[model samples]
Target: MSLGEDGPGTRTRMPEQHAGGTGRRTQPQPRRALVTVVGVVVLLIAALAFANRGGKSDGSAAADGTSGTKAGGAKGSSAASATAPTGQRPVTSKTAGIPAGFAHSVQGAQSAAANYAVALGGVDMFNAGRRHEIVATVYAPSVSAALQSTLDRAYSADAEKALGLTSDGTAPAGLTFVSRTVPVGAKVTASAPDAVSVDVWCTALSGLAGQGSTKPVSSSWFTVSEKLVWTAGDWKIQSSTQKQGPAPVNGDDQAATADEISGAVQQYGGFTYAR
Candidate 1:
């Protein structure tokens, strides 16, 4: 979300000058303080720019409305249906990444929310570093510190041990720690120029699901409600909560092969939700 100005142009070294009649050597002056200040300022600007970026949103949904309410497509905008999304950016973040709002209108908040859902709910989230990255890139700055701290406590050493992983979330040899989210759909529950709320339905995979694994990966359907704010030039999370169900019953059909499941995870990529 944050963007920065490129570094200062190359410095030209000055020739040594005689300080006195004798070859009083002129020592090279280090621009350490200047460079440090420039670096800090650049980082600060980028952080502020990204933190305060504006996002588009519709005013249909209100604060007093019921939770889990869905907003219709026609009522929002025709921006998403105008063209197909290219690459991995999602049908949403068409011109920007990290939940950058749609460029055309104040309605792209739905898209930004959906794309962020994918980023937050991905399998990589289980990792401590990845979790921090998710919060930093997708969450509002005010809450990220607290959220990550809470997550750090909850995702404890014992939790990792139970999942057959080390304290840092690394899987044991010959095994993989899998926690992936596959998005099903997205909808705007509420929207505004500076804020938006979206719900995403998804299926998540956890555990190895292989032989000799007690925590065999199983599938569960869940919904995530994300409240976003326009900050630093992108939509950032204000808060989020999850719920179970709205999922369909499983058929009696036999489970797919392990290789089949793994292959599907690799071959079938995720989507950037919209509308």
Candidate 2:
């Protein structure tokens, strides 16, 4: 299967693997469509964001449904005094496996979006059940219902097959699927008591791991922008969008083997990110 920018929707015939010895690099071109799909989910987040933001005036808190707070937590905005980290853990609890109960401050909102991005851009997203759980956990309740169905279609079976996965989203036997997002930093674009928008610069690793794997895990850089709402004592993602990144020049370090990369992924557990 070949990959394309449309993500899971694009499919082509899979090329036959060449006869090779152990640890051969004679693999076929990887289907980067999987990578594109990984990034596109953020677009779904943005769609939901607009839905959540609809009907709210863009002005002060006095404006119906708007929170009056300026950027950087200025005196007039509840976000004022919140420009810096509170040094406090953003949440004391978890909801359906997602962090919950964020502080009602700008810092907390940024932290929530950063962490949510990591969760959204993860391996679980390829798996239907887990994907639903993550969405419900991080997205506002008001939008998750519709978002779930939307995402289901977005990550369709055709897309999975393109990436060498089974229609059920499982990696081929003996191959490990890889999808992860690491946040480099976050900046609040806008902040208010009820709404906050943050952009998180991040790098994502995706593809697969296995001997003779065509897609031997690769990395890409992207930025995720999230609009969050203070809801039910936590910051829930309302919308999100993504763009190709602010990537730096390549490093001089030598690339590792497929086995080594696979080992590292298994050995290193992901963290609960904070801004």
Candidate 3:
């Protein structure tokens, strides 16, 4: 008979004793075998049911109304929203030719970091006058003077000459120098009412772009971290540092000619970054 054909408590027939043999009846071997098989089947079904219930419970909890509130909680939500753009309008003012008047919020901190990074990484920083203006305008009042002094030393005449520029930070004749930072994204690492820290990921083009130039324009990726404080009704850099990127592999596109690159740089304008 097939397994499970009879109920658990069903009785099975026993073989009749031989006429001349002792009359005590014995339990049937087949009945005992059937019972053992049924028990094993029942136990396997119960185990499978338990495993499925555990899996579904976890899934249901994640699918509860809120978005991205999975097993990792706030961390998961932050990761989901980090690069997602909000439709809020960007700041509409400038100070010292740099974007200013950011909102006093986490998004504002990120926006400030990105815009400050662009200003700091521009070719203007190579020029003493422009560099001093940028540092004064972007950095906190308490730190601006010291920061300016340090930068002056770092971008000295020797440094300009090494980069194929004149002592005044002018490009050599017949070449256009390119130093531009394009922010890929920004995120706030820490934030409070009065201060915040943000990281801005950027790709930059730097070097001389023209025929006969030894330093052809090249691209690089880096991340800049800035600590900003709310001072004088604006977000200003208190400190800053940079590190080499989470760079992607270089693509196979052919390099543009010097004239083309220089023209493109001149025609395209930089942006006012926002979160």
lDDT of each: 0.46, 0.57, 0.57
What's the CA error at residue 120 for candidate 3, in Å? 0.2
lDDT of 2 at 169: 72
What are the C-alpha RMSDs, in order, of all predicted structures? 19.8, 13.4, 32.6
lDDT of 2 by residue, 1-275 (tens): 11011101101112122110011011221112111132233344221112222122122331001232355544332232223333454354666566667667665676677678777766667678987998889987877877777777667777567667778776788887777676766655666557877776677677678887877777667666777888877789776666555777878988888888878777766665554
Model 2, stretches more than 4 Å misplaced? Answer: 1-42, 45-86
Q: Per-residue lDDT for 71-149 in model 3, tens only?
A: 2225323441424336545687778788789777666666777778777767777677877887888888877776555
Q: Please report, as a residue range, the 10-residue window in candidate 1 with the lowest summed lDDT.
A: 18-27
Against the true structure, candidate 1 has what lDDT? 0.46
Compute each candidate's TM-score over C-alphas: 0.62, 0.71, 0.71
Candidate 3 global lDDT: 0.57
Per-residue lDDT of 117 in model 2: 74
Better of 1 and 2 by TM-score: 2
